[model samples]
Target: MAKKTTQATPKAAENEQQSATAQKPHILPDRVWLVLARRAYEEPLRQVGTVEADDIELARVYARSIYDEFAWVEMALVPRETLVTVIEA
Candidate 1:
């Protein structure tokens, strides 16, 4: 007696793939945002702190609300994920 093996058809394989993909958890982009602020005109922007949000607008809101204690002349938020490091410590 010999063992028998079965192979899935192309459509069945595709359906299985699709089902597996659907069953996997949907991963969302949660990023740490770097907050920078300048106190006055001609002042260099400095990193104040970081904020966490899923998108830029939400990050901006979070940064402003969290760091609003200072009378900053300007403020900006950049997703830390987009930054490239030139030097490593």
Candidate 2:
């Protein structure tokens, strides 16, 4: 006859999660960066996607890696905070 073993209970898992979170300090939320790119010289730059990053350099790296679907002629990153609201939506 084979021996039977018991699986971990939900309470035990919850305790482990609590301890893990307690050990680490709270972190600030990442800033949102708007990605804009233009495929051709004649075309206007359009918003392709967005990325969350700690700084501009990291944001640039993330934008390039995640939005590599196009061979854009020009690419730019604008911080979400800098944009002005011309029209309320």
Candidate 3:
């Protein structure tokens, strides 16, 4: 007895490739922005949340919209990639 093999049709193969591509995670530049907020001028800025955006404008909008739980007097967005880990515990 011989083993049987089946071949996929061109259309079905294309569809399978497309579905595989869709299922794979997209490769995008590091766009994670760390959201920092301060309750008062004297208070130190604390990490509140993070947002992913392609640009600073979008990051600003996302940070404001997503982290609206508190009425922070000052809010800032810093690119996570630029942050240098001084000490890692």
Candidate 4:
């Protein structure tokens, strides 16, 4: 009689996958800022005015630093490759 080989059960495979996933660092998604801004906005819009702040460039700098800080965990990432479309009727 020939001996049969057994593969790892699904549960074992799943556990191995989970452990591997836990070892990686977190990835900051592109929408991360939008989400952060939304949460920030939750606190009443302070200094509401027509004046614009030149913070976009500053934010880009911060984002670059943040990206290097967390470059592992995988998640839905959005790249700023196109202009945001505003649909107004």
Q: Which of the numbered candidates is closest to the native, going by highest lDDT?
A: 2
User: Candidate 2's residue-wise lDDT over 24-89, tens digit each?
Assistant: 758767899999999999999999999999789999999999999989999999999899999989
- List candidate 3 segments past 4 Å from native: 1-30
Cα lDDT, all candidates: 0.90, 0.94, 0.90, 0.42
Question: Candidates ranked by TM-score, best first?
Answer: 2, 3, 1, 4
Top-TM-score structure, candidate number: 2
lDDT of 4 by residue, 1-89 (tens): 89999999999999999999887746543232320211242353221112111355544555444444333232122333332878945
lDDT of 3 by residue, 1-89 (tens): 89898899999999999999998868665489999999898999999989999889989989999999878999999988898989986
Poorly placed runs, candidate 2 (over 4 Å) = 1-26
As for candidate 2, its clashing pairs are none
TM-score for each model: 0.64, 0.70, 0.67, 0.27
- Give candidate 3's TM-score: 0.67
In candidate 2, position 40 carries an lDDT of: 100
Name every residue pair that clashes in candidate 3: none
Model 4, runs deviating above 4 Å: 27-89
Worst 10 residues of 1 by lDDT: 23-32
